[model samples]
Target: MRLAHGLDINHPVHKAMVELGKRLEEKSNGQLIVKLYPSGQLGAERECLELLQIGSLDITKVSAAVLENFVSDYKVLSIPYLFRDRQHSYDFYDSTIGKDLLHKGGDYRLMGLCYYDAGSRSFYTKTKAIGSPDDLEGLKIRVQKSHMAVAMVNQLGGAPTPISWGELYTALQQGVVDGAENNLPSFFTSKHYEVCKYYSFDEHTAVPDILLIGTERWSRLNERERQWLQEAADESAIIQRELWRKAEEEALKTIKKAGVKVNYPDKHPFSEKTRAIMNMFKGDSIAQKLIRNIKSMN
Candidate 1:
């Protein structure tokens, strides 16, 4: 099996993939193997998904925000303020509704294996701090190539610019974008703090990363192979969460030392600004039901 992703090799997700390969090898008694291609050697998130669909790649990981483009059900995960807290989001992923959403992409030849903790996303800017949605006025905020992300940024009163992750660093340096939003670890690892000095903990969204397998490759696996692979992936998710927690702590300390101005803005105003994003999906019954079900979770 070949697993490819766009994250750096030091990323928690990549470390978890290493764990997956080790566990799968142990479970299969050396009969099955997983080859990893990190740092977008094959392609970006969308390109990796396309490769998976055609059986050119066996597995890949992507943000739920990116997955929203291939599977409409995944749009729920990108909604701002959807999950109350980290544990709340974890519970939803382990719930039946979450499992159902995983398979919702089968018709598109994509199958979700599991969800990895991506932490929450917050805003970081180069010029001024984003204390509130009002501060975002006229600022160009970088967003992923997902409609939900675009809408969320628009709702927050910023101009949304979709750019590939690889091109973002240059884009930030050249002032093509005024700012971007992401988790602490990503901001630190990507070294965006060098250019974007202000980091705000508005934490508007807690989007998880998903491990995906193509249906074409999945169909070829025998029952035993499937069980072994699934077990490996399930265990990897647990390992990945712990790694992510540690990375977040280290990233916070490191970025602070690097002279990044970090602040904890009141989340209510930010949440309130994006509240209407839910209404954007009112016409889609699947999305509406998902919203109701997720909110009902304890």
Candidate 2:
């Protein structure tokens, strides 16, 4: 069977994908083989999703935040303060809400295999320390091309500039964009912190990395093969979460050593500012249901 994998080479998510591939090969005893195309060799998340739709690629990893652009239920992950902490995040994923989300992609031809850890997102800037919403005023901040992300940034008073991750370093360096928000490993791995000197620990959204397979391709797999792949994905997720936690700590240490002034701002202020933005979604029936469900979880 010909299987194709795609992801950004340096992304921790890809590391998890590699682990998944390894497990699949081991479990199948050489009957199953997967060829990985990391570093956007196949394309970025959106492009990869498109490829999956046409059955051109077998599997890929995508940010839950990006997946929200296509799957509305996914926006639940974008909600700030939704999880009490890491444990809460994991519990929610293991709950009914998680099960529903995994199947939510079926309509779009993307089958969610499992979820991987993507550390909490925080602010990193070129010159200014983002202590509160006030500090974000007037700054041109780069965010993923997600409406929710853009709304979150706008609520903080900064001009939200949607930019792709690949071009962010140049955007920051050339003043095409001023700063960006992401997790520590991403900030370090993407080398965005090199241009953005201030690393703020606001810990905004804690979206997970979702492992997905093209539904078209998955349908062709025999029942036993499908079961084996599902089990392998679950094992990979467990391993990746552990690695992600370690990577987060190491990333923080590495960035600080590189002279980045890391600050834990009064997150209350940041949270408060975004409340208005969140309220707008209060009327969204689907979003409201998800918000209620997550808050009810723990």
Candidate 3:
């Protein structure tokens, strides 16, 4: 059997997953081989997910923020300050709840295999530094496709602009957007730091990149094949986490050396400002319960 995977190859997670394919081929003794299309060869993250749904692609990885468009339950992961810290987020994702989430994609023809550590997202801006909620007023900030992200930015007094990942560099360069937010490695790897001078460590959200296989593709595998595939994905996730941590540290140092200004602002104001976003879900019993459950994890 042969499978195809797609992702932005520049990322450490994708690099680690490529290793997974090598391991899978070895473990299966040539029963299964995997092909990879990195650097958006398949398309952008959202496009890749859509391809999976239509069975045009066998597998892909996407941030939970993007997945929220397909599975509303994933919005829980996008809630600002959802996880207390990195360790807390790791603990929750390794629990039963995480397994349940991975399976939630089945309803959309997406079979989630595992989650990669994506680190925490914070803001980076071009002309001004965001020291407080007030600093965001009137700034057009690029956010993910997730409504939670748009809501958070809106509540914080900035205009939320949802631009494609590929367009962000130009968006920042042409003043189409004043700034954008993402984890350290992404900000560095994508070279957004070249356009965005100030990096703020508000560390608002921690969204995991989920490796997913199309349900049709998954069903095609026999029990033994499925076991081997799953084992490879599980192990790749472990390696990806370590790679993410090291890349994160390196990104911070590399960008600082690139003449970028780094600021660790008071997070309380940013957090307090976005509290209203969390309340928007209160009317829905299911979402409210989900929030409480995640918060109760630790």
Q: What is the TM-score of each candidate against the true structure?
A: 0.99, 0.95, 0.96
**lDDT of prediction 1:** 0.93
Q: lDDT of all the models against the reference?
A: 0.93, 0.83, 0.86
Candidate 1: stretches off by over 4 Å: none
Cα distance off (Å), candidate 3, residue 206: 0.7
In model 3, which runs have C-alpha deviations exceeding 4 angstroms?
A: 1-8
Model with the higher lDDT, candidate 1 or 3: 1
All candidates in order of TM-score, best leading: 1, 3, 2
Quick one: best lDDT, which candidate? 1
Model 3: what TM-score?
0.96
Residues 35-130, model 2: lDDT tens digits: 887766766778888888889888887888889887877877887767778998898778878877888988899989888888799989998899
Query: lDDT tens digits, residues 123-163, model 3?
Result: 99999888998998999999988898999999999999999
Candidate 3 lDDT score relative to the true structure: 0.86
- Every candidate's CA RMSD: 0.8, 1.6, 1.6
C-alpha lDDT (0 to 100) for residue 290 of candidate 1: 92
Model 2 residue 36 CA deviation (Å) reads 1.2
